[model samples]
Structure formats: structure tokens, C-alpha cells
Target: MSKLNIDQKKIKQLFEDKRSDFLIPDYQRPYAWGEDECQTLWKDIFNFAFPDKELEKFNSDEEYFLGPIVTFENNKKLEVIDGQQRLTTLMLLLRVFYKRLEKMKDENSMRTKQNLAQCIWKSDEFGNENKEKLKIDSQVALDEHKNEFLEILKTGDAKDFKSQYAINFRYFEKEVDEFLKEYPSYFAYLPTRILNNCILLPIEADNEKTALRIFSTLNDRGKPLADADIFKAQFYKFYVAKNQKDEFIEKWKNLEILCKEVFSKKDNTSTDEIFNRYMYYQRALKGNKNSTTEGLRDFYEKDSYALLKSDRTFEDLQNLGSFWQAISIQDKNYFDENTLRWLFILNYAPNIMWANITSVYFMKNRDEQNQLDNIKFAKFLEKITAFIFAYSFIYPSVSQLRIPIYSAMIDIINDKEMDFSKFLFEKENLKTFIQN
Candidate 1:
């Protein structure tokens, strides 16, 4: 909460500064810029470096804004909270330029390589380039990914590596090589233009908490990460502190795969969708159904992210993900035809109010055979479907169904028997309305 330190620096000033080592914190999302982003960046800088007038005519005052990087100082190293994707990609691009330059005997290429070396690696007290270390590292990524990235920088070899880091590095390699071949004279000028003209704004916070809050609010150059992405970091920290991170990672990846295959992207990412469904189940457990629902991030993040800190919450999420995956794929082991028939009807219902209600029921009622309590589940689905359809007609707005369905969800969570006596049923009106 201390006063912020904000500064704008060109790539040269930013990377050549000895005080500015960077670390992608263990909680940050992995580098995710794909080939498209790399290409877009290359094209932008290419156009900037080689304008229609001529490379010699390029304006020194004109700068390509690369965007902001948010970080907090940790042990003299800046732990990146946001903008790791751009920063990482830029480093890869710089390394590609360095590798190509290393092979050239020209004075311009060697001078550019020296500047870039200081950018990519730390210099000794005497200002000699230290090839042993890189200026940035990613603790957030998988071990293999971490190793691959460092290896690429140190050796310029990405053989047999398929991670985004490796892929993007190779992409830059190809682009740089082609640019060199296509415009041999202008090729050396490319890195100079990029290193000296591209602008990156750095926002250094006084603490990690404030930096993360900033990250959650800021959108990346690409899509802001899903709420589940933030939640994953919390879960990862919790498990790692307990020395159970490997197990958690395995389970988390499996859950991601299941949700990706089962959930549609119409509303949100598959992981976010499953999280939303599980949030409803959590709300039901707390007997909180009447008030407006909190956003997926706000709900888990409240009370210092108490929900994600618990093993129970993660287990329940995995269970709910599995349950939905079964339904989505219509796995015969999970539900009989009769229940699925009602499920099909409810799926087409005017609102998704039935979904969480079904989730709560299944969680409380599913059996050891990986099947629903078929008779009870069928009857419950049938009743819920009838309630939804009847209410859809009788009510003027879909919001009117929220409380009743939420109430039903709570009842199911508490293992209470359903009785719609409090509802308007209106059998004659319902029948007449249905007929029309």
C-alpha cells in the first residue's frame, strides 16, 4: 500500500538495467502467447522498424508501446504479477536475435549482440556479460517448461520441446531468419529498432498482495485469464505448502481435461463453467440462496480465498466435474435412460436454473456404483422439470424461479424431502396454459 513506483522505459533501458532482474512468481499463470501473438508483435515491430518511406527515414521519436508490466520487489528481484506473456516472448525474441547475431562477423551485428547480451543476461561488476544466468525466470511454469525455457536461452536449442516457450522461440527464430534472408541489409537494423524503440511501462508495487489485486483487475494483451486460473494458483499454493503439490497438479490437470471435453464454451471456459456450477453447490451448503450471487472470483476470493484453501472444496469440485462430465457424455454407468430422458427435457428448459439443483441432488444422492439413485433421481428430475416448465409459464420473468430453485437446492443439499406445496402448482391453469 505504499506509494507506487511507475516508470516508462524503452526495451534497451528496461533490459540493460542491472537492477531489474525479473521472476515470474509461482502463482502467476504460465506464458500463454501463441504463434498469433508472436506474429502480430513481429509485424508491428517490422512495420515500425521499416516504414514505407525507408529504414533511414524511420523516426527516432516514434515508439511502439508494448504495454505495462506489473511487479513487486522480492529479494531485489521483481516478481511479475502481470505481463509475463509479453515479457517472456520479448526475451525469446531477443535471444533469437542474439543467436543469429552471434554467427555474424560484422561490427553492427556484434555490437547489437553485446547490447542484447546485457539485456538477456546479467553483467559482472566489471560490465562483462554473465552468460551463466538469464535476466528472467518462470517459477510459475511446469518443471519441464522452466527447464526448456532456460535451456533455449542458454543453448538456443529447442529440440523436441513443444511448450509455448519453445514454440514461440522457434517461431521468432524462423521469422528472424526469413527477415534476414529477405532484407539482408535491413536485418541488423531490426533488433536495434526493437531494442531501442519499443516501450514498456513498469508499475512496481510495494507488496505482493497489492500487485496481485492489480493483476486481477488488469486485462492482458490477450483475454484476461479465467477465474479458475486464479483459483488454480491458490490451490497450488495450498498444496505446495503441504508438500502435496504433485498430487494436486495431477488431479487438477485431469479435472481440466474432463471439463474441457464435457462443458460447452457458450457461456464460459469449461473450467470456469464447472467452477460456476460448484460455486452454486457451495452457496447451497451455506444456505445462501436468496441474495444475488457473487461473481465467481469474488465468491472464492472472499475471506482470503477460504474456499480454495480447503482440500474438501477441491475434492467436491472434482466430484462435481466428474458428475457433469458423465451427464454430458451420457455415460451409461452414471444414469439410467429414464433419468437422462428427464435431464434431456430440462436441458432444453428456458433457463439453466435446473442445473445446480440437479448438481446438489446428485452430490447428496449419487451411489457407490458410480450411478445416481435412479428411482429417486428420476422422480426428482421429473418433479424439477415440471416445476421449471410450470413456473416458466406462470411467471413473468425467469428471475422469479431463482429463489424457489435455490431453496430446492438447499433442501437437496440438506437431504430434506421435496414438497412443492409452497409453490402455486395451479393444475387447471397449468393444463390450460400447456394446451395453449
Candidate 2:
């Protein structure tokens, strides 16, 4: 929690001399900060160095300041816990500085370049036997650091890096080359001396645990965190507790597979969004027809009924089969996998009208009622079908209307003396419902 005051000179020196003392473990995710983030950091340092000019406004102070440098005491080494992006970017800038200094033949520039190089590239030799352990000579390590620097130079846009920083390295390089052709004194002073900077707040904490915590909280005040990020945090909590990281990952993979197989057939659907939506819908209904749209975005994003296919459990599979059975009785000819899949919505309704029609017929005679006799249920089926079609095709809006429409249809079915066939063909109701 203590603030270590490492200014620009000290920062440059530390990177040049002590860079070999820091090592990023393979456990850390690969540096994925794109050009925009890199440019932003450059702009932040530029503004910090030269705050006088009314430069373009930044989104926030935090955006202007790099978060923190966390130093972790490993068995014998100091591990950098956070701010790797900034640190890596600074190293690239130093490389550029070193190259420019070498071209200039200025003793002062040469001395500064050597100092920066020693800070970033040198390792203290403990003994002849232990030299390799502390040194920064491994091919893998060199390639990674080199690639990190190259990625910044290659990807960063000139306008973003220059306008924000008030100095374009590419432009500076070209200008210096031209000037050296003439005046040559331009190389005597290193650009690093002109750029004032401050080291990020250094936090000392248990390395791995503190890194996760700081990363999570770093941008909390900015745009909301993604669900995937939150899920990863939660997953890690349970995973670490049980020492079942592998098992947790496997379960997530299994859920992903189930989700993909079930919802992939649906048109224009996102699997993750759909799974989240279905979960919300189930919680919303709670075995009742009434549910709110508060979290409905999750389920509506996917075809809920289609997802039933992925359930391997006996009870879930049976419920899915029963749902299809009801759909078959209603529209025998229209009974395809797609139509049957759509029937899962009925399970959300209070009254299972299709199930009721099938039940009544089975009760009347031991033999299944002929399709002709089932004609009496046609009107009931028609009303249900019309409403569903309207909801799915015509309106297609998720709202309170679903409950009322289902409720009205259920009432019609419950009237024992009412003939569904006669009621469905009634011109008045059809016109009224359609118009409304």
C-alpha cells in the first residue's frame, strides 16, 4: 500500500538496469492490449510530461495514470504483479532511444543509452554457477520481449501516438535522420531526457492473489464488466476452493457443448445469451405462467424449447417427449422437429390445453381416439395455434400480452359445454384478436 516515488529518470534507469530481475510467468495471459490501449497510455505519459498545452481531454484521470506496479517477493526474485503493458511499452521506447543515441555519436547520449540498457537488460551475477538463473539470455525470453516491443511499433497508429504524446517517434526518427545529414547536434540529446514521467504506484502484496484482485478492481468504475469476466472470477473462486480447476473447466466445457448442440439449429441466436436467457426465464416462471422481463433478455436471445434436446437426464428427456406428444395431437401433419421444439413454450403456461385434449380422448375410450374424433379438439387447437402463430410470427414482441392471450385460451378450453370447433370458426373472435 506504500507509494514508492520512482520518477521518470529512475523509471528509465530501473528498466535499463533491473529489467532482468523481473520475470513474467507463463501463467499470466499473453499481452493482449491492442493499439488503442497502448496509444492511450502513451497519451497519458505525454500529458503528464507536458501538461501546459490544452491537449485533448482524456476520459478520466485513471485513464491518464497507469494503475500500479505490484512488486512480489518470490523465493528470491521480484515479480511484476501488474502494469506489464506500460512496462513493456516503455522498454520499446528505450530501444528506440538507444538506436537513436548510437546514430548520433554523442558521448552524453551514449552514456544515457548505456545506463538505460543496463537497467532493462542487465542481471546481477550472484555466482558463476547461478548466472543463468538471474541473466536475461534465454532465447524464449528474448523473443517474447522483442516481440512485445515490435508489436507496439507495428500496431500503434502515428496520429494516436503522436498527437496524444506530442511527439511521434517515426516522425522524430525521420526528422533526426534529415537533421543529422546537416546539423548532427540533434542526436547529442536523448528524447528520454525531454519526456518527464512518474512510476505507477507500487503495491507490495502476495503476487498471484494480489494480481487477480488488482486487475479485477482496476477498471471497476469504467464501463460495466462483461458477464464472461464475472463468470471467470466466480469459476476461479469455486475452482481454487475445491482444488478442482480442471473439473470446473470441464463442466464449463460440457455446458458449452450442451448449449451449442441445442441452440445452434435456431436462427440468428447467440448460445451464451440464450443459455443466460433460458436460466432467467425458468427463474421468472417458477412453475407459474407469470414472469417479468427484467432478466428475460437472456432466454429470449435463444430458442428455449430447442435447448431441451441437450438434457440427457431421464426426467428432462421425458418432459421433452411429453411436450412433443401434446404437439403431435394438436397438429399431426405439422408435427416436425421444429414445430415440436416450439411446443416447450406451452410448458410455461398454467393450463396444458393440448395435454388436456389428449387426456380427455384417452379417458373416453381405452383405444386412442381416431384423428377424425379428435376433430372436436380442432377448434381448441386452432385458437392455440392462431395465438402462437400471432405471437411468434405477427407480433413477435415479448411482453405482458403473452400471459393474457394464454389465459384467455385456457378459459375457452375449460368451458365444458363449449365446442372448440364452433368457437374457432366464429368470425367475430378471430377478427377481434387479429385487429387487437
Candidate 3:
């Protein structure tokens, strides 16, 4: 049982020292704050900071609660599990203030600038800041995402306003200028108020498991999390334990990009789609065809997330991602025309079981050259298509097709000479299936 270290601290207190380095892992969502969220935060903090009183002195007891951040210590850094959006937005806001203070040489302005610098960068004993070492890092998989935030923080602004980092930073700048225009005398106090008054509850867990459990429990009613996020956390833990965390991060980023490009998304992410497909492959390997399929999270989370801890699981997933990408883009270098045609037909099938079964077969049979056994693949697809359609019409209910498909998938996994006839309907049922 790991103990959680819970502490409530002011915003400046959380990030004012070199000890406060924060890392948002690769699996978390990128910064998503838009104008509305920034506006609401700005309004609340500004009102709290000013209090509609004479600007000379604010009540020392006044504090604005800025919610909580969940993190665990990893390799001497705080790996953020939750509250990255707020953490990121605050950094942008603070950077904006730091940049604004640069133009003013007044004692208050310079002092506020120094405090903000300590929050944004690693400072020396002499109070000089190391611009190279930012206090926070977001490792989200978007291209140049981490660099973009760093660049925005190091420099005053960004030309590419497309990023939420840039957008929110610019928004804060605009809000700051508007405030300066309205209250020139009070502008210097704004940063002080925000840094000293804004508060965040820091929930630090002793391990990633505890951190993730806390994350899931907290978000149960707030926002639905994708199953892939939990799986990624498990993989992160496994890879980190092996000292291969950097390698895993790169592979996971590629997986994210590939899945988003190649897989279909209804409600789930492309990563989720890949996992969902691979779940069938695992089921087949276990030869547990009789058990009903479970929800994606529940399936992967069995035995304390035992499935994701294996290196083979992730390797198979990478191969599966590549296989699906080929199918999606019709990569002629790897897949023949006949196979693609059958895959097209299978895509239109009433249920996704056909595709899931095909994923299992691909994992078992895919060659080192990354090419499918084209003749076998085409033949397999044709048979599976016919079998799935026939079963669909005869059974009508989706669950009725699972046991047979699951059995066929097991046979595929074991490299058995598939007897497609075993999966076919009886002659009378076949006649009824075709007639309908």
C-alpha cells in the first residue's frame, strides 16, 4: 500500500524551485484549453486578485483555489497524471506575465519578473535563471508539441496561433494588455496576485499504479477515458522498469500516429481500435472461445493488466498497426489486389468480428518482409467474408456468431489447416441464409 502525499500550495510555491520539474507523459491528451476556458480562468483570477477594492493592498488571507494536479515521482521528475491542462495553461499565463514585465524596469516589475522566472525555469543559487531548463515538459505525441511549448515560453510569442499553447498564450497577452490599458497603476500587482493567491492541491502518489487508480477514480463521473490510455500507462510502467522508457515512448508515438491515420473512429480512438482488434487475437491464442467478449478496458485490465506487461503484446500490436495501415491505404507493396478487395467487402459486413478474426490471422502469419502471404490471405478473406455474411443472416443476433468466429480465430492462431466447412451453416440453414 503506497502512501499519497497531499499538499495544497500556491501556484508560485508549486513551481518556484528546481525541484518542481513536471512531465506530462506521452499518453495524455495535448493542451486543449480554448478561449472560453482561458476567459473563465482569467475572469475568476482577476476578480479574486483585485476584489473590487482600492488597489493599494489586498486582504492577505484571500486565496483562489485552482483545483488539483495529480502526479507521481519518476526518475526525479513529477510525472503528471492529471491536471495537465490547467498546469499548462498556468505556465502559459505566467510566461505571458514574465514577458510583459520585461519591458518595465520598476522595482515591483523586476521583482515580479524574477518570481515568474523561478516558476518557469531552473534558477541558480545566484538567482540567475537557466533558460534551457523549463520547469515543465509535456511529452504528448503531436509533432513538435513539446518544442512548441518550449519555444513559446522561451520567446515572448508564437506566429503559429494554431496550437493551443500559442492560442492561450496570445489570449493571455491580449487580456494583460487590455488590463494594462484599463488599470495602468494596478498592472504590476496582477502577477503578484496570481502567483501568491492562486492555489492548487497537489496529489502526489508513491507509484504509477496508485496515481492511475486515483486518476480513473477521479474521472469516473467527469469525462470518459479511452481504454488505450490505461493500457498505455501499464506499458509505460513496464518499459520504465526495464529502463527502456525512451524506446517505448517513440514506439507509442508512432503507434498513435499510425492508428489515427489508418483506423476508423466512431467513439473510440484509432489506438483503441487496434487494441480492440488485438483483444480478439489474444482471446484466440488463449482458446477461450466460449467466453463472451468483454469491454475493451475490462479485457486488457484482467489480472492486474497482465496482458500489457509482455513485450510480445506490444510487438504484436505494432505489427497489427502496420497491417491495418496497409489495409487502410491499400499498400500494394504489401497486400495484393484480391486481398484488398475481400477486405473491402469485409469492411461492409454488419459486424466487426470478421476484421477482428482477420487481425488474429495476420499476426500469426505476417512475414518478416512485412508482406502477407497474398494467396493465402486472399483465400482466407474470401472464405471469412462468406462465412460471416452467412452466419449473420442465419443467426441475426451478433452474439450468435462469436463462438464460431472465436474457434476459427483459435485455429488461425495455431497455424492449423483451417476447415472452413466447420464454420459453415448446415445445408438447410445455408439455403435459408442465401434465400434471405
Candidate 4:
């Protein structure tokens, strides 16, 4: 927290300056926000500035904190290290207001347009006509999307545009149009609220390292948080704060890179999916019943955050990623040949119950590769898979075997000391695991 050069400024103040140019670095992720994020942000702003009777009466001088933007000045442009997502979304909002003002033909129409222009772009000078403001300098693959972003901002058209930026732009336009329907004068107070009452904490650092370090330390109150994002920021701050050597930082980075690689291969394999599986395995081993996403997120930030903030935690999470990746991509290099063959049968077994359980076991024992661990894991894997298959083949469906099958799985997960053979092998002809 000590390493900072912070400034408390308003959102309007940031855009009013013609010289303000923000440069998003190449390493930064692309604008991946969708309607879920956009809707949430819209609700936040409307509730704050809508002048509803229920909203607390406040003065124009009162500021609503929009969150922080960490960056450093590089020549004339500001190099953005964090808060690009929020800033970009706000810009889209301003554009919607600007467009609305142009169609109104009111006495303050020209003045309002002029003010909105200052927040969006710099006036073109005779000597330099094509200056870039709000630059999203992304990797080559994402470069075209950034270009499309600039185009949507300028034209405010959703046609022929397909990125999340375009979709959110149209969404704002509709929301604002709807707002004007009931409370026509909302914009009159809204613009001033944004300029004078809405806050933007712009922290200026001396270099990229310092900016990133500051970003890592930020709590990001009121903003959407992913476990991986916060974990990276916290771990980076720890690396610098504790004066850990470069070796540790490098290892931590490899974990992040490995996660990105594994996550990028599919659409459904994001943080929630992987983290849910990890949580299931952890709780299942301890016989705990909490397995929902909210449960896992709460557990991570509350109990696990304080305990696992170290180099070793980074290694463990990365290894867990590898375990999930193996199951996801159908690669069994992490398991021995016998276990791999067992997994093959489970995969073709026409059900996913046991496969899910086996994936959790792999995640928990990812590092425990000794003979005993292997033997226990394999037996555990086979017993579960074979029981599922046998139970299905012997009984009709959940009608005859639902309660026993589910109850056994629950008891087995919760009571590790319980006998494995007693509940398994229910039918005489086959190796069933539940009541025949």
C-alpha cells in the first residue's frame, strides 16, 4: 500500500482534458465482457445518478467511487495497467449520452455535445490530424478487434460489428432510450453527476513495474473479481513486498501461463468450471457438503486466502490445473497405464457420475505419485466406475436404485474410514455397488 502516487479525481475530469490518451498494453487481455457485466454496470450507474426518490439526497460535490485506474505517463499517452474494462465501459456510456444529446435539439445541445467530445477524443489540430486517443494496443491476433472497438465508438452502430464492445454499445443505447421515456430530465442531472460527483481514482506510477505492483495491491472494491485475477495481483505484490528472488516470480508466472493455455482451448473451461471441480474434490475428501460456485468462492477468499498465499500454493494450483486439463482434453499422461485404461472404460460407460469422481481424485493426488497413492487411487477409481456400470446394468433406473446409489456415494465421500466392500457388489451376477 505504501508504494503509490494516488489521485482522487472525477470521471468527467478525466475526459474533459483534450490531452488524455490511454494506451492499453499488448500483454493485456482483450475486452471479454458480455451482457452480464454490461447489465450490472448499467444498473449501478442508473441507481446512483437516476435521482430516484429512494436514492439518498446528496449534493453535487458528493462523489460516488467508480473504482481505481492504475497507470503511468509515457510521453503524451497514459499507459494503462488496470481498470481498462471499467474505463472502456464508461466510455461507451458517455457515447450513448452524446448521441442522445445530438438528437434532442435543446438550447444546451451544442454545449453538452462539446463537453462529451472532450471526454471521448482530443480535437484534431491542423498539424496533427490523426492522433489516437484511448489506444488498445493488443497482440496482433486481437488487433482487429481493437480496431472494431474504435469504429463502434465513433459511429455508435451495432451493424457489421460483433465484439462484446459492439453488443454493449447497442445495449447502452437502448437502456438510455428507455430511461428518457419515463424521466426525460434524468440526463440533465446525469451529465453533471458523472462529471462532478462520479469518482475515478487515477494512480500514476513512475514505470510499468510500479504500476503493476500498485495494481496487484488494489482491493478493487465494487468491481467484479475472478479468483485467478485477484490471486495474481496479490501474489505479485507478495513477490515484490517480501523481496522474493526472480526465481519464485518466474515459477509463479509459469503457473499463470499454464492456466491460460489450458483455459483457452475450450469455451466451457473457465475459472468456474475448474475451480468447481477443485472445490468438489477438496470438500468431498473432507466429507463436507458445500459444492456450489458461491460456496467455493466464499471459501477461497475467506478461509483459504489467508492460508494459501505463498509460492507453494501457486505450484499446487498449477498442478491442479494440469489434472483438470488431462481429464478435459482426454490426455491421461498423469495417470499410469492401468488407471488410464480404467478411465477409458469410464469414459465409454454411458454416464458421467464416476468420471466426475475420478477427476476429483486426480486433482487431490496430483502430486502424490508413489506406489501406495497410485494403488489407492486406482482401486478407488475402479470401485466407483464398476459400481456405476453394474448398478445401471442390474437395476431398471433411478426408480429401483436411485436412493441407494446416491446415498452410497455420499457416505463413501464423507466417511473415508467406512468399509468399501460392504456397499459395493449388490447383485449376484455382476459387481454392482448398490442394492440389487
The candidate that wins on lDDT is 3
Q: lDDT per prediction?
A: 0.83, 0.42, 0.84, 0.62
lDDT of 2 by residue, 251-277 (tens): 544544444454343432222343343
Identify the leading candidate in terms of TM-score.
1
Root mean square deviation (Cα) for candidate 4: 13.1
Task: Evaluate model 3: give its lDDT.
Answer: 0.84
Per-residue accuracy of model 1 over 1-436 as CA lDDT, tens digit each:
3658889999999988987899986656657789999999999988888887277779988999999998999999998878888898999999999999888888888899898999999989887887778898777733447778888888878878988889999899898989889878666788998999999999899987677667667763445556777788889889989999889888888987888888767433678888888888888888997757778887888999988899888988888888888788777777798988987788798887788788778777767744577888899988988888888887747788887888888888887877766676768988887777
**Pairs in clash, predicted candidate 1:** none
Better by lDDT, candidate 4 or 1: 1
**Alpha carbon lDDT at 192, candidate 2:** 45
RMSD of each: 3.8, 13.9, 6.0, 13.1
Candidate 2 local Cα displacement, residue 231, angstroms: 11
Where model 2 places Cα greater than 4 Å from the true spot, the runs are 1-10, 13-20, 27-29, 34-66, 75-81, 124-190, 194-196, 221-436
TM-score of each: 0.83, 0.40, 0.68, 0.52
In model 2, the Cα lDDT at residue 179 comes to: 37
The segments of candidate 3 whose C-alpha lies over 4 angstroms from its true place after superposition are 51-60, 105-107, 125-128, 155-164, 220-268, 282-355, 365-408, 417-436
